[model samples]
Target: MKSGQLNRRVIVQRATSVSDGAGGQVREWPEIGRPWVKASLWSTGRGAGGGQSAVADVMQDNQAFVIRMRPRDIATGDRIVLDGLNYRVRAVVDPNGRRRELQVSIELEVPENA
Candidate 1:
């Protein structure tokens, strides 16, 4: 894939644990950088949230985006933000088997909407 084909601008974020000083940890997502990626969305549907009785807590499994980039700088826990939507990294694969290009599978989360 050509680098110029990456049209989507996404902010890269890493999940970090901050010391609370109370023997507990506060989780935070800190922005590491921004990278342009080529995104392809698929399989948008509603997903179950919590328990069956908690229908109010139901979530929408909207659009799993496949992003193509160079190398595998992102891990499973890391995520990308684009247009107010959070795309959590599900998996990363090198298509060339030489680490030249990485295809990242992501699950999209739209806050309360999904």
Candidate 2:
């Protein structure tokens, strides 16, 4: 991928678990940094809804994102915010295997309260 196609400014986020002050834990996403990336859909699938929070397990539409090589560590469960939507990272891989770039496999997240 060319550098020009990666025009989308994206904020990388990672989940941090902390006390909710009620003896329970809460997951908070903190912005790691902003990076430019080329986003594209890898595949789309039909989703079935079971309960309020089981939608993602039923089906998922996965996307493949290509971003400029980054120096930080990227992992699963990290998300990229684009156009105000959260694309949850399902997997991260070095596409070229030469460490020139990252290929992030993702799925659209369905809010539990929505």
Candidate 3:
């Protein structure tokens, strides 16, 4: 809850639909706000396939992260970009119920060939 704990910079973005001039709408992620947050690694999981063939084994990394920052108008399905990586907001909570701080839970899944 202390300001000093918020050492990482993160950009909060929301999905917006814009007209593509073709009678259709395109989803765009626009920056809503940037805030200093404290990010902590909650959990991590790695898995591989049972059998490998010609293709390399797929490595899936699911990471759970919790970030704490000042209260803001953020919601689920919003994205938090940090260090060029995008994370999806899973849940948000006001830990103190005073609206002074928010504990946001976010998740990131990376699939790579190993």
lDDT of each: 0.71, 0.65, 0.75
Clashing residue pairs in candidate 2 are: none
TM-score of each model, paired residue for residue: 0.74, 0.72, 0.77
- Quality of model 3 by C-alpha lDDT: 0.75
Shift in Å, residue 23, candidate 3: 1.0
* Model 2 vs. true fold: TM: 0.72
Q: Candidate 3 has which clashing residue pairs, if any?
A: none
Tens-digit lDDT track of model 3 for 12-113: 999999999999999899999999998877533322122111112221246667788899999988999988888888778776579987878777735355
Reference-based lDDT, residue 3, model 1? 79
Backbone clashes per model, in order? 0, 0, 0
Off by over 4 Å in 1: 43-61, 110-114
Tens digits of per-residue lDDT for model 2 on 1-114?
Answer: 567867778888999999989999999999998887766544344332111122234235444433343445777788888788887877676645677766665667778897
Residue-wise C-alpha lDDT for candidate 1, range 2-93, written one tens digit per residue: 87888888999999999999999998999988988887654343332211222212224556766777774688769889788888877776
Which is the leading candidate under TM-score? 3
Worst 10 residues of 3 by lDDT: 50-59
